[model samples]
Target chain A: MSERYLFRGNHAIAEGAMRAGCRFFAGYPITPQNEIPEYFSARMPDYGGVFLQTESEIAAINMLFGASAAGVRAMTTSSSPGISLMQEGISYSCGADLPMVIANVVRGGPGLGNIAPAQSDYFQATRGGGHGDYRTPVLAPNSVQEMFEFPKLAFELAERYRTPVIILADGLLGQMIEPLEYTFDPVDPKTLPKKDYILDGCKGRERRVIRSYDLRPGYLEKLNFERIKKYQKIEAEEVRYETDHLDDAEFVIIAYGTCSRVAKAAVRLARNNGVKMGLLRPITLWPFPKKMIEELTGKTRLFIVVEMSMGQMIEDVELVVKGKAPVRLIPHPGGGIPTAREIWERFQQFREEL
Target chain B: MRKVYHRPEGLTDTLMRYCPGCGHGIIHRIIAELLVELNIRERTVGIAPVGCSVFADEYFNCDMIQPAHGRGPAVATGLKRANPDLIVFSYQGDGDLAAIGTAEIVHAAARNENFTVIFVNNAIYGMTGGQLAPTTLPNMVSTTTPRGRNTKLAGNPIRVCELLNSLDGPVYINRTSVHTPQWVLKTKKAIKRGFEIQMAKKGFALIEVLSMCPTNWRMSPIESSRWIEEVMSKYYELKLFRDLTKEEK
Candidate 1:
């Protein structure tokens, strides 16, 4: 049975991590993400776990790396700038196929832009960051309940795929309080599949060397191919999306996270006005519901992409739309989220155009 | 109970590719030989660093992960966290650990990260040619410090063992040299102690071996070892910084 409780998105995440058997947390506190480690630091010791507020994001990631090497569930949370500091470690985790979770509570950015909410890291998170040919599972949580459940799923997915999985949320989602339906139950690690690729110690076992060096051109290529194969599997099986009220709509809006929440408001208003509009939120930004959206080309005549950035994800929308429908971009920058009133105005204007 | 001299199970038949008189060759052998004795080669995950030993991954004949320069500790830490069941170690050079990755290695030790660190202090950059490193001794002349290192401007040489010893988390920190037959034996023992601490799942352990970089030092392997003993050991003292059994909580 699903458990329920009252908590903020950040607390929900902390509760979810605890539920998912994450016993180690190494994070440098930043705006919107400070609560996670703060919560864990106060609670981990009671569970015989560890919570370290590292000197910097770099140290936190490496510390998380060490804990993960021990075959324990470990994680780290940071805002955009801190996440930027951690990208190198994240890429290494990917190259090594290390199972762990990295939460990015995105705030405004380009360069330490602000301490306010923003989805400007869309390109960086969804696409691979750092110097590498690798991709991590990117999960976008839209609500407080998702914040509670995603970590359990994220950890499971990471271990299942033997790769890093990112929980992409914004400052707003991270800080705002809501009634979360978790933090009431504990997750058992024994029920999970056994992970054998850890370095506990060379006692009673052969020396286990975990490395990611494919120097031989042929060998490196083979490793790359294998990674791609795994990515393909993830794309096929892990792509999650939610569609609302578009069965016979003429116009559909593509968004994720907070943007989707606003688009829903617009969808409701436009539907009442006989404007036939709906919402398509992409939860897994990496696998991208391109095929799912593609299948809707017959029904989705006009595509409207709403985002907090300068239309980064719209590119993906256009790629899938394939010019089949006229794709429109509605972007708002700075510290503000797109309000329902503004979205409704835009949706109605686009409604008349179609 | 096991034989003291058999090749470790994880180590392959390929001999290390380090140059003659290279301390890394001896260190690698010692680690592999110890793994064989302990019989845990299959569970050993090595985080390889960039340097003359950048490809140490290939030579180690184990599951190795190549991390960026000075980031081996970070990578090794990640592996250990994700797989607490594995025995993880990072083998790094002075240039990789002390200079480029100064922050990473230092903070890792400071945090008392649970793992083992094999720090080979050769005092000079060997892989990239005869360049002066952070650990280069005073008055030492290399390609960069041709006229000798200016203590006034170039600053004092780094003593890794001393620096690491000052940290709070590590279980053991020892400085050993590979200058002579006797010292080589001692260095091997230090490396084993480090691995043993890691086996205990104790906090961080490190062995900073003052090694000779013959090709980079612009001297014969024998002279390089002599310089290590005469000059390097002077700045870096040989002793245990923290012992797990005595100091662990």
Candidate 2:
């Protein structure tokens, strides 16, 4: 058995990235996520990694673009407003097909809403946040253990796809403390496969150019089509989610990240109270559990979607359900998190109406 | 027959797309020649900015990356810090360096990043039609400045070398023009010095080259050179603003 330690979500993310062979990190300080940069500043040098407190989120993301193009695993973390500043660079990374990881410890938003936990960036994260014909795979982690384990998986997926990956967490998940165990052995970067498209130099070979624009008549169109096929393959192969009591579930609760923790509790509370409620927590938000939801639609009576937003992921669930089952939203928008009692009470009322 | 002059091996066979009499071709040739002379072509990484030289990745025979507009310095910082052995350079224009990317360049210099910056100041935006640039001279008319540039409303032009000279981080800061053959040689020397300082791991260095934009200036190639000599040079002085090498010696 591996050793277990009590760690905060933010510090676990930093340690996880270090063990995953992340050699470069550049980020600016922001609310709720400041611990990530602080942890990296204290520990990254000991790991023989580069740590840069960039001037702004824009510079941090662009720095990741450069470092990743030079063939190293790089990452950055920010909150919502800062992540907004990084959209341009993120779009450029997608266009250039460079691999890197970004973590957004979400907070209330529209504009500087608050530093409390919220999931208002679902549309922004699932849909490409920047101006481009592209999509970034998003991982939603609910626990400190998932936070500790997700970076390695995120880096692997990023390199495997040659695309940016986002770890979408909230302020609550980042600040909470929990005990976790290291699931995988530490990875040595030297043992990793060599990247052929890196821009180290043109020593004894043809020169390489990493660029995003093709101004030719039909070149950009062809590039977009190729990228679409890659995204399609990802959609088919990479959908991840966790289901609890789905075998005999009459009422299904669909959620992700911090909201799903409350949802899982509500499911157990309903089961003890002699109700048949189930939970489906989507781990990958972009390659959503569409097929499973569609399959569940035939047997379920009602799909209750719980979120900390006005209702972002519900649109995806509803799209897949396609009116086959009745879909309802339990929203706790803008810094408010639902409790197990509150969710169970809401479910009781909905079931009475049904 | 002995080869009196030939193309530098650092440049590819691709034909350049710069306009007639534009100074980008001249500057590109100078950089290419120096890359061959320094024998760092095999280990050099060049950053192309978002301007008329956006296609520079195709022209330079080295590993290149074209990042967002004005983000060349930040990208170079990443590349150089990640792999210190790679000689990195950021090639940018007036709009790219002074207008959109001011924060990145300022912070890179403040950190004393060991990289070279090739700043081509032509006093007007070239790629996006002829708009007034941060370096546009007083009373110089551009597409945006239908009337002569009013210092009251638009503010005076920025002298980049003077501004950066105020900061102690930069090791070498020079401003040279390419209007005449003699001045072109001087500009080449300044660029070589910038790269040499970076190779020695000294600190940040920038060579600001005063270039001609004849199509935007509404002048003939000969007239543009004369205007740079007479008008543009008076406001943005042609001189070395700082040099730490001399201090060390």
Candidate 3:
């Protein structure tokens, strides 16, 4: 394992996927994340992996569907608008019960908004960006190290659940450079679970058919119920978050990804000024750390929700809070990261109100 | 007991849900028979499109995938790239391949991906109850074109074989039909050849089968076959459009 190497967040994700036994990569070029495909385009061949700069985001995700269906580790990376184009394929993958990784290096958008980092896609990511009764484990990575680590983590979760997993990152995290250490050896594909469902030519066995179209009266209901059970299991086992200085704290600021990193700095400054602020960062946003937040409802008097969107995650926070405590939103809108000083000012306002 | 005929091992015992006298049943049998003959059933993957053949996976005894409408080629590309030893093919209807999946099929051919495509051109959106398709002939009436297809507004039928021939990626590209016993045998042979090319690890291979849609065409099965020969085949002629392997020889 190397101690350190200069890597962009996107490149770290690409390297992590390759080491995680991703044998196929297909993606379309989109901003702040273009380096991911470019890295794979150069490195995959050296490892005997397949890399395709697909014609469109739709094609890329479909390629992932095909590769994953064939019982190989596969992935694709895109930003907000590109991810929207892939929802159909994403839903299809979930229905087909294929395991794969997808990274949304999110940028601002309701449409083709600027390529700057923004958390506006939190709703789209955590709420099944694709259609149907399915949920993808969404992992939010704040540091370049987590960016390197989450892809591998995403693959394991995807394989364990036989479902897709999403690495919900934003542009600033994607474009930023950091020193990363390779702490793991590359995964050996041969050691992966036997995919009896893979389409590997049915010569020595009964033919395996992987499909999602169950048109019978109660067939879909049965399948959807099974999917719900799987989601329930994931919810029970995969809730992840980090707490900072929460012991004896009166005010807590909740955020994730790049915004959480900013909130951490703001909390530090607020604590220096005796404002008693702590930071709670959600690492897995899909199976959100609801219990942790619910625990704070009575213990903490005020909870601050900071984000790069118009109060998207605040809804989830409120659901967990259950009106036990007052909550305020500090929105940074889209296209830019919120400053720590701005967050500290908000903490001051909340402290004065208290 | 000298068995003169029986179902191939590549097919399940389950009866298909296709309409009576549909060409899909015949085509399905052809593919199944060939998979057994080639002994590639276990290592073969088929991508099903979102048309009537979306249920093709139900009939095939091999591993199968049903992708979104018109995205079979892209899915096939991924499968083939992931495991070069696997025999991959996509089964697509006219609307699925020509209308919505144009980019996927075109780029797949352009990439020279080593796989086969079973393109079924029924000239109407069969599964959707006879809507006009990209291959619908001029003056042909469909639900969407109640007054007959107006070439001025709807454009002429696209000749998929000729269109793909313009690309150098495909190692083999052919068009055949299942209207008559003679054409049915020919289409089967073309399909077999397409599979052989795929087994050889040659580039993309496509076999377009001009099929009959009796229910969608508002005619008996017999009339539908006649219509295919007289109308559809006239515009989409049966022939081998390209064979790059031949050029290499």
Q: Against the true structure, whose lDDT is highest?
A: 2
* Error in Å for residue A43 of model 2: 1.0
Which ranges in model 2 have alpha carbons more than 4 Å from their true place?
none
Q: How well is each residue in A43-70 modelled by candidate 2, as lDDT tens digits?
A: 9898888999999999999999999999
TM-score of chain A of 1: 0.96
Candidate 2 lDDT (Cα, 0 to 1):
0.94
DockQ scores of all models, one per candidate: 0.44, 0.89, 0.84
Please give me the DockQ of candidate 1 compared with the native complex. 0.44
Model 1 bad stretches (over 4 Å): A1-3, A183-185, A201-207, A349-354, B1-11, B33-46, B55-68, B72-89, B113-115, B138-156, B168-171, B192-204, B237-249
Worst 10 residues of 2 chain A by lDDT: A345-354
* Ranking 1 against 2 by lDDT, winner: 2
Better of 1 and 3 by TM-score: 3
Q: lDDT tens digits, residues A36-149, model 1?
A: 888888888776677777777887776666566667788889999999998877877787788889999989888878988889888988888776788888999999889889
Q: Which candidate is the best by DockQ?
A: 2
TM values, all candidates: 0.89, 0.99, 0.98
Clash count list over all predictions: 55, 0, 9
RMSD of each: 3.6, 0.8, 1.4
TM-score of chain A of each: 0.96, 0.99, 0.98
Q: Candidates ranked by DockQ, best first? A: 2, 3, 1
